[model samples]
Target: MRTNYEAHDIPYRRKKAAGWPGWNSAEEVHDCIQTLNGLLEPLEVASTADVCEIGCGAGNLTDTLADRGWSVTGVDVSNVAIHWARERCRQQNVTFLRGNICERELFAPASFDLIIDGLCLHCIIGEDRDRVISNLSYWLKPGGRIVVFTMCGEPKGKDRAGYDPKSRCAFSGDIAVRYFAKAEEIIDEFRKESLQCTFQQVVDPPNEQASLRALFEKPR
Candidate 1:
């Protein structure tokens, strides 16, 4: 099996500084931003709302959200990435912090109006993954929203260069595996915990990398 460190390899700041075009490419990033923006169009978030981004590597989405006038706080496990985000996203309304999502304590209860979880979930496994999920309930305000983008419950192609999905638990694949979750599984988890799904979509890139993006709301 693969370790979490192996799965989350490559310093985001190093790649950003070297102009690595981000995980996939500029096209992927642009499409993600545009699609997420469109998905949030009818949400009606106030300009004064506080937005917190989990796993905001290099502040890519954090910067975009800040540009939309939200007070943004981005947290990532990478200190290098946090430093990079601070330098790259200079908006006065934005702040970047470094910490494990499972142990983060910088925010008070019922703090954020919106929490962004980008493509970071798929990189973790085992009890660590569960801790992150459970911790989400503590960080969000009642009636707040969470936007999650992650790999789906599809079979990985052997021919593809991407990580493979294992049977049973998503962690059984390998050290380099990218954990995937079904939309239904995600919704069910939230439902059991008193959250409701507002929207869900499976996005397939030209490269055949399919992902699910979902927006959920916690009951007030």
Candidate 2:
């Protein structure tokens, strides 16, 4: 199955660089990076921590994480995105891998101290959720933390046409599957898989950018 990236990567990358609406927003980019760093602060993420950033578009956030002194590995499904991310985040500690994060083999088992998902999880629903969480579980070292920002409010009706309230899974457009979760639902999704919820907060402002930022930890 092809993803939105496989279909629209070239166009998205161009629009992203051109500062087009819906595709380009420096404020959103800033929000993503700053929020991640803020989350890492509470976790006391050390300089030596091995960090993986999922859907690391253009390295806006990934480069910043590398600057924060961590060894950062940025993963993206788009070869085009990964190309720019590598160039954008040129650093001794930063590396870029082009592949699906849902595939466990993309990374070694128990290899990372932290995983950051900036608007990635919201796009994965149903069985794909299990694939993603399994990869996260496999790659994260014991006691490692995962910080994710996802859609938490009412699903955007236009994009979420076949959303099931009972399951909180939304199928958007032909190939897109999005998920929306309540705060409790967010905690429950991870707790069921032995990942403990450490922190959860709703970001309610900035209009269309409202999201839920949650942190989960793998047991040591």
Candidate 3:
């Protein structure tokens, strides 16, 4: 699938400059960590649970998960991001791979207990989104959880457009990033797929960006 940003340019510059650590502020990172922690609460799973983080930018969330004692596998399309994550994490249990989400062969099915999107899902567009969801569900173990955070909007429709100073471009550029669904929409979609979904809203510190958090479970 074609992405809005110049795959080589900004991703390369951003990767080299500060790696994935520069993607968001320390405060923003803290909020994401807290949000994931909250979602994992009811699961009551061991901290050693196997976790996979898709689009794990600089590995910030992956690092956080590792610190919490989870075995994490972080995947990203950018080679720079993967390299940065591998170098920064340096933990035996944390693995980083560069790959496309549309292809499920990269990782074994039913491999992870928890799969995290961390704002990456918004980047996928059109039929690619459906393929991604299908692959993710297929790869998850029964009763496994998938946690996602993204900009709020209706499910399966056009995304809202605006400039992002960080990326120095309008949302995903020409095509714009797809905002699949809001909290309610996410729940509905999961239900239709026979996956249980729990939704929540997370406001960044001082109420900056409003991100919708959804926790989905594969039926046992």
Best by lDDT: 2
Collision pairs in model 2? none
Candidate 2, 38: how far from true, in Å? 2.2
Clashes of each: 3, 0, 2
- Candidate 1 on 75-183: residue-level lDDT in tens? 8877767777787789999989887786747667788898888777766665566667667767898989988887766645642445344532343344544556676
lDDT of 3: 0.71
Question: In model 1, what lDDT does residue 53 have?
Answer: 84
lDDT for model 2 comes to 0.76
Runs of candidate 3 exceeding 4 Å displacement: 1-9, 15-20, 154-173, 178-180, 202-207
The worst-scoring run of ten residues by lDDT in candidate 2 lies at: 1-10
- Model 2 agreement with the true structure over 1-220: per-residue lDDT tens digits: 2245454476557865786432237787777667777877777888889999887767787878888889999888877777777665689999988888777799999999999988877766667777788789889999998998777877653545777677666644555456776756767778877998888898776446458888999999
- TM-score of candidate 1 against the unseen true structure: 0.84
Q: Rank the candidates by TM-score, best first.
A: 2, 1, 3
Each candidate's TM vs. the true structure? 0.84, 0.85, 0.80
Residues 58-145, candidate 3, lDDT per residue (tens digit)? 7888987888788888888877677677777888888898888878797898998999888887667556667788888888999898
